[model samples]
Target: MDSWVDGQPADSLSLKDRGLAYGDGLFETIAVHDGQPVLLDRHLVRLADGCLRLAIAADIQLVRQELLSYAAAMGEGVLKLILTRGDGLRGYAPDPTAPGRRILQGNPAAAYPAVNAEQGIRLFPCSTRLSHQPLLAGLKHLNRLEQVLARAEWQDSEHAEGLMLDQAGRVIEGVFSNLFLLRDGVLLTPDLKRCGVAGVMRAEILFQAESLAIPTQIADISLEQLQWADEVFVCNSVYGVWPVRAYAALSWPVGPLTRKLQTIARALLDA
Candidate 1:
């Protein structure tokens, strides 16, 4: 019930798969509710971009149909879609004949305590700074050792998430989510031109903000700027949005901006 590989029921992938051997693949973590995959078109758009960048042949129609089918079967949950360069001959060279593989898996929808959404969650300032790679920026590729290391920085229940900074000490994003800082009635997220995943929920919020006339910008944001922010929220497609109540020595009361966006985000998820 948890997995399907290449449209067939299977748990194990080939050992020679490029995704495992070289992290040569892209992925999307989507939220499914009542048989609908939220922001599906947006997810597919991103997946296509990744495929183009990696020069991987993408069967978009097949991938989209399969995701919908998988999500419907699961009813409501989280869906992890992985598309790899398929099996390859032993070496660093990519196999020219490889026809990509699709691996879909599911998890029960996570239940965030009401307080975290109603109030906010604490954040740990991770010591692991993300490396800069402009060419690879914003793609949800399989190379996640950086995030894995950052998440390992803490083991405390008090911190619900870890805030990661880039090499320049600019706040890039949360370990597993995107971050937005509301400052002086403006919405701002760290620009992913240099690094960080351009999350699907982040895209939705940006579009909604534009329609609502809520000023939004994307640029390099420093820790001091976030410390002085009126509100800060972290988001991902699976979790929607979570306000940041406390990070390091700073504390913020859940503000109007985060609430306003959450309303739209929830509606978009159900739409």
Candidate 2:
């Protein structure tokens, strides 16, 4: 399928676009099923929040309409929406009133081995660490050099994902997913206050946990804490949930809680 720039079909963008120049933008990777975008409202809420935080002037209503139209045409696939601060001059200072540029690219659904979710996956201990940036911690912004570097640390099929830690040696998340662990029946996830992308799936899982009456905690996680976990799993809006069986030498089983949440996540994604 052809990509759309704003509301029109285009394969090219302006050379001076700020998203290309300075990475001044936000993006959302949405799942489309049966010609409808899954978690559409949640994705938009995150996009709106990012625009607000970055002070990028974007037309949310127009974006929503474009997404609906794009997803309807896509039918079944993934839709990536990029909102940039239009084009800009050669500088760091941004034009506060510039309307954001919207680009929609469609792709087929992600292809991951079923074993990663069924039997569990091995987590590569990434050497790359996330930097501390409180202002941009959870926005799913365009600047992703850190993740790019981290992902490049692995190049083998032996590992399904990589575990990323912050500079302070606190466990943060995966290269492209949010992580969660269970201990003593309490679900715990690393706090993204200082860094890490607050993934849409992570938010949904938290809400689901609450509705299920499961206790969940968001805190600074340590390597020591991960070693003590009864069950560990990673999640993203695309893959849903993947149970982490091993990270380096530490290992964990796909516990009952992880399986329970995995079922719920599967239902949500497949819906």
Candidate 3:
């Protein structure tokens, strides 16, 4: 693995970086295959959008070029792009003139659980609930303590994932991926207006589903409603899409619709 910090040949970043100090940064984890990044444009767009929302000055072209160079060296791996508000003084108020710093790191993608892809996954309902914060709901910001804590609540290998609920007890998403449930032939996902990282793969799935004429909705979901879902799936850019075969004691098939979506998702990535 190799890394570049602000175009410099360095392996370590300043501990005083505002990102470290105040979590004032955004990041994107991209999947690379066959010497190309899957959904590169979408990831870049989201990163740029996050910069805009946070009042950070980001050079999209430069970032893209750096990512391509890093990917070329990596061959096949996951690329992590981080943009921080740079080092700042003792106060919380940021200096409007300080230029942001960018870091691009590449590492080999971890081997995924093969059985999960074929047979499907089993999930647990985590006791930890997500806090509602509209301001940080959709951005892939550095504040991930919530997910860390939620994931720590379980150590069982059989539990492939943990389903999280919002402060209102509404089912929101998984520990590291977006959640979707199928009910009465319609697909439903939690609205990110309250809290959750708006995953790149989630956006792609929603868009492709619309194009395929699949009925989909973004709404609040209760645990009761989720328990009745015909099928369930969790998704992220790196893992693509994984069908949830069991949640608690409830089980489901890897349904035809989910298989179809997975096909499209794989094709999109491999394209």
TM-score of each predicted structure versus truth: 0.97, 0.99, 0.96
* Candidate whose TM-score is highest: 2
Who wins the lDDT comparison?
Answer: 2
- What residue pairs clash in candidate 2, if any at all? none
Q: Scored by Cα lDDT, where does model 2 land?
A: 0.95
User: Where is model 1 more than 4 Å wrong at Cα?
Assistant: none
In candidate 1, where is summed lDDT lowest over 10 consecutive residues? 90-99
Q: Quick one: ranking by TM-score, best first?
A: 2, 1, 3
Error of 3 at 236 (Å): 0.4
Candidate 3 minimal-lDDT segment of 10 residues: 91-100
User: Can you write out model 1's per-residue Cα lDDT over 1-271, one digit (the tens) per residue?
Assistant: 6699999989999998999999999999999989888999999999999988888887989999999999999988889999999988888887555558999999998877877777789999899999999889999999999999999999977888999999999999999999998999899999999899999999999999999999999999998999999999999898788999999999998998899888878877776
lDDT of 3 by residue, 206-270 (tens): 99889988899999898888889998888889888889998777888888878888888878767
Alpha carbon lDDT of each predicted model: 0.91, 0.95, 0.86
**Local lDDT at 105 for model 2:** 98
Candidate 2: segments with Cα more than 4 A from true spot: none
Candidate 3 lDDT score at position 199: 93
Global lDDT for candidate 3? 0.86
